[model samples]
Target chain A: MLPPALSDKQTVPFDDRGLAYGDGLFETVLLRAGAPVLWRYHTDRLAKGCRRLNIPLPCQAALDATWQGDCTAELEVLKLILTRGSGGRGYAQPDEVTPRLLSRRTPFQPSIQRWQQGVTVRLCDLRLSRQPRLAGIKHLNRLENVLARQEWSDAAIAEGLLADSEGRVIEATSMNIFWLQAGQVFTPLVDQCGVAGTLRAGLIDQGVVAQRALLLDRLAEVERLWVANSVQGVWPVTTLLAADGSLLQRWAVSDSDPFQRLAHQLLGFA
Target chain B: MLPPALSDKQTVPFDDRGLAYGDGLFETVLLRAGAPVLWRYHTDRLAKGCRRLNIPLPCQAALDATWQGDCTAELEVLKLILTRGSGGRGYAQPDEVTPRLLSRRTPFQPSIQRWQQGVTVRLCDLRLSRQPRLAGIKHLNRLENVLARQEWSDAAIAEGLLADSEGRVIEATSMNIFWLQAGQVFTPLVDQCGVAGTLRAGLIDQGVVAQRALLLDRLAEVERLWVANSVQGVWPVTTLLAADGSLLQRWAVSDSDPFQRLAHQLLGFA
Candidate 1:
């Protein structure tokens, strides 16, 4: 018999390891036309993360059945979090482990004006720590991202780019970034840190970009810059600034950024 | 009016950020005869963690009322967790944030034999990342400790010692470690990584030990080693080993260990 199906407005047990120690993995999926987008990429990452963290994969049948939840909206975000279930008050896993899958919904709304005109970003003083074990996968322990995102409260700054302790640009606070230089597209490698975003994966699979380590200083010479994620699709970065608002790199936006146009076509983002 | 009182075996709302991004802090206190051990240290750390993270402190009146929750056992463990409650999508804090207070209890049964006879420990392959924003406080983003603690399953080895990526000796999987050299006790400073445990703070407050940065190679020259926490009291270290089980340092436990005897008195750990 299968375990319980996903329910709406449910309460998490206080004993969940997800709350206790962040011992889990999560996927934020964009649902359009009552179905999940980039499902294969999401599943691949989920399977990979569960394997690496030794959390048993939830039943595929049960997971698939939850897609038809009472979502009548044309577009929405569905969050799938798989925790290592409840364990006693310690870090050690019990002899028997049962993974808990929790799904929640939120209304999806992306700013068309920001995507069209492009947006500005600033360098975050907070540096992401390098941990190869948790490098590419999106795990529940995202205090670094939270801390980095909170560095700015201004609505003018769309995102904050985070570099590692060694001065390598890993990713933005909540998205993966790419740059075009010499007619070649490059994205930072996640080998040392940063989440290997599904949108980045899809772009690489389509051969639209190549993976290379980019340092914070090298961003100045790039011809064009863009940030992409599953939810917000892709956005052109107009200006990149240091922590003190000193301009580091500037770019012009037109109807003609080849990489940005390609992302719009691929993700069906108008 | 005061907030709702803590309930045993309760449920956490699905939107709690404690599970979402590991955005919170926790303190584990030993309840002896319905009185919390190290109450002042626990509150001090909790208040400091909240101030740093900007999470509001819970009502002290409500907190004190819950400490007597049907706990009849002479010794038990009470875990108090404070989380940023019910956030919408993304990392930005809500304009009006309500912190959630979750408390649970467990049976406390420290190994008398292990505490008296001492225990063996091995170096963990997983090194703690250095994040000063997260250092010293016992936050909910503990994936590093979870990974380090799962490295060994042998009951013979009671704990795993963790060092920072810079090779600075930091702490153990679940406790703070101290070493004595030339009649001076020193513990690795928590400014870079590791939790500033309540027991460790108590020891420092009593002038029993001083803080110092230690390299992993320096463990060999230490005269004696011990690990301490609120729940388990203290345990003497008999041997320290490398990840491959190679002996790195050895020590002899004696009943006349002044440090151990003092901790026993402070914590009332028989």
Candidate 2:
């Protein structure tokens, strides 16, 4: 269901920075029980991204109303997009910036069974370029991710992993990845590239895992793995393959693992 | 005028990857005397960029028709945007991709006096994040450029220069910058960041200038400075300032430079 605030939409101005240059940031969160999870984190990231882009963040009340009321669905995916409003035909943004805040709800959720059974994964040919300045932030300039996700479509393949130019395994196309190596848990350090996922944050903050750069050459050493995003919560990777397209490892994080237990507790999956 | 092609205008599907994630490449060239200046270079770069992003290059027939009826004006700016067409709601792109090419003409010609007197420039506080994969290519993920351009409203300031996270000077908001330092021309290498501008390439190809990484500290010491873009041709800089809100040196290239003369000849400037 489309959010009420966005129901009376007109044509997004041709000069909008978002359309002209992808000059914007967006956050997608799982809406359970008709309430957006981690609303604070999503809003904070949106504001921080706006500040970095020199766009003034919009009002919180207005934003909350846009996402809050008139939603009948209990489970949905809520997407928030904030763009530097229209201006000069060229890239130069207008002096008086009018920001656009939009919210929409879609009745969508990943199959719970898939998360439990673990999903197949592939290694994408496209690499996420290292951009420390833009890394760890969920901005709208996601062509790299788009290309990475496009690499495979077999229903058997659930997600694709991307690496940096230096062959450091960064993250999956849409989720933060964690691998259990030598009984230690680690996820890629997003300081150089990849989004600092909200769910990843909760897991890390809860002392379940550490963040470090994962070199692609060492993929064979990992014993178990899983991916997390705001929407998917936690999905075990049943299989990981080598770049030469050979099986590397398979993983199943039982609900018994302390980390998995923590994830379930934090995500309300418990 | 909107192209008659608009009558049946097939453009980005509502969910175009380009529009959603800025997964695309674009080229804007000057159409004068009924021919596109630097057409081959523009098309070559576009094809290379498409390959980098894994999007199929447009067909020759589509390319020809993109600009055929357009550019009717005696002189105009012809812009062509090619995007990975629709689908893939998330980061994943569709298995089969249809690239959308939109061509339009804009009436634009920089004033002769502005080029002669030189334009004012300011350093942008918004540093461009370095993403080498997208560097040197004219892709649509240009939020940094948009933010830098939004910094000030002083009409006198014609352009803003940006640096990367490490404080290395990159490029101007909308153009490539070149300066003569110690009797050798230098432009920041785009390997770490920034676009490899078409006009900048022309100047280097014609053996009129040299190119290299330029430090922000060295910019003030340059004997002369100029900025170039496909649409703006070239313009000398009379003033320079750092993003720290400090004044740098000012410079204006002599009108007698062979490159300036060539620009005048090619652009039909008096």
Candidate 3:
């Protein structure tokens, strides 16, 4: 189910800027019933990333063709990467910009138990660096995320939460985090670090979540917490682990819980 | 010329963590008379980078083979990239580490005029972010360098200088910078940001330069300034430009100047 532009026969060039400098952006989209779910949100985010990175956007028609051609799988995870082509010797941009588009599809596997019973998460010791210029866009400069994810290897721990150098909770390794406090839904403001996930954006647009600068101390006051991404939708967090991997707090999610309701709404999106 | 591993026929896998997350490090060595100019320094830096990034060091035999096989060009730019390899879907590292090595060679063109008469450099508006965990290693997460380099397009300007968010002068876009005042050489400490370059390491080891926290105001008191790297050796900076491209300061270099002596010592290495 790979896109024609990124089939098994295709190969990324050795000098691709994406490989050399991580001068690129990517989007992971969920496809259901042979159709890409939240296609507009993904493309819109990609467009924003291109503008921020100053890389020319690939034609919408070309992207649509690839998506349509590859969306045959009933349930699939589509990954698209856009790099600033290749051939600049150093930091300078190439004189001729030919943005490369690579897409691949894999069978989607739902985490039913995690979505049903919720999952445990731990705090990562590695604090994200502040770079307002590259704060929100899903750029390829993701060493911070990699380091954070590597902090824990326990299969039982679903995700690792990251904070900025200032001790403000930013996000999970690969998802946006939202918490309910006194019936108010709040997510971290990603103005200084962290990616603004597509699902989080959609939730914000729907007036289901508000963005705020979250501190580590404030987590004690959260009634319920959940992490969200485009592919997995949302997962209620049952336990929060401290830096030493010790359980710091716990929560129980009932069927009527707002977090559970939000998860259901996201997962049931067509 | 190209190393067999990185010839035009070679291709980087789409899922390589290096491409996907900038989870890699690279080294560019200068070749003179069919030999690597600073082989030990380059390898040492690569080893340090791998240790910092938690990527397994590529086998010594493989690295030797690539370097030894591609030194045919009398004056060549040898590039070596060591990536975390492929198959980590998200931010996680693959269970089995199979680091990939890519090498390339290009004809070296020395900037003799810039070295002899000095070149003009300007300050960049984009301030580098503080990431102590990633500081000093030449990792592939170089979007900061790209954005800083893109600040100006004038061919007359040889390089652009960068500072950290705290307004501390760091380094040039592609090279490490050093300043001289009253016979003392000082370079910005890269512990907070910027690459610890091979040439800079050599200079520091030789006891010719000292690392210090340099501020923008300190530039006014500098008697002489130069930037150095593996490929270009060293280039004396004749004029410094403000962010608005206006002349900020100027320096004259004589043939017997200490900066010129250091440049000759660096360039004459074989």
**Candidate 2 per-residue lDDT over residues A1-270, each given as its tens digit:** 122223135224444556568877778887777787777777777767766677777777766765677666767887776667666658766656677666567887567886678887878877776665577878878877876765676778878888887899989988889988778889988887888888887778778889888888787578887877878877788888654567877766576665566776777776
Cα lDDT of model 3 by residue, A29-138, tens digit = 88787577778888888888888888888777767754676455678888888888887758899887777888777888768777779899999899998999899999
User: Which runs in model 1 stand beyond 4 Å of their true positions?
Assistant: A1-9, B1-9
In model 3, the Cα lDDT at residue A27 comes to 90
**Candidate 2's C-alpha lDDT?**
0.73
**What is every candidate's C-alpha DockQ against the true complex, given to 2 decimals?**
0.77, 0.44, 0.81
TM-score, per-candidate, Cα-based: 0.96, 0.85, 0.95
lDDT of 1 by residue, B1-270 (tens): 235334345677777788889998899999988799888899899888988788777777766755766786888888888787777448887877787887877777888887889999999999888889889999999888888887888889989999999999999999999989889888899997899999889989999989999898887788899988888978899999899989998899987888877777778874
Order the candidate numbers by TM-score, best to worst: 1, 3, 2
lDDT of 2 at A210: 94
TM-score of 3: 0.95
Which consecutive 10 residues in model 1 chain B have the weakest lDDT in total? B1-10
TM-score of chain B of 3: 0.94
Interface RMSD of 2: 3.2
Q: Among these predicted structures, which one has the highest TM-score?
A: 1
For candidate 2 chain B, the 10 contiguous residues with the lowest summed lDDT are B1-10
For B1-270, candidate 2 gives per-residue lDDT tens digits of 112122134333335555568888878887875577777778778877977887788766676565667455777778777777666658766666666667666766666667777888898877777666678889989876766777877787888988887778888888888877766666788887899877777767777667777767777877888887766767888888776556787664574765566655544553
Error of 3 at A171 (Å): 0.4
Docking quality tier of candidate 3? high
- Which residue pairs overlap in candidate 2's backbone? none
- For each candidate, what is the lDDT? 0.85, 0.73, 0.83
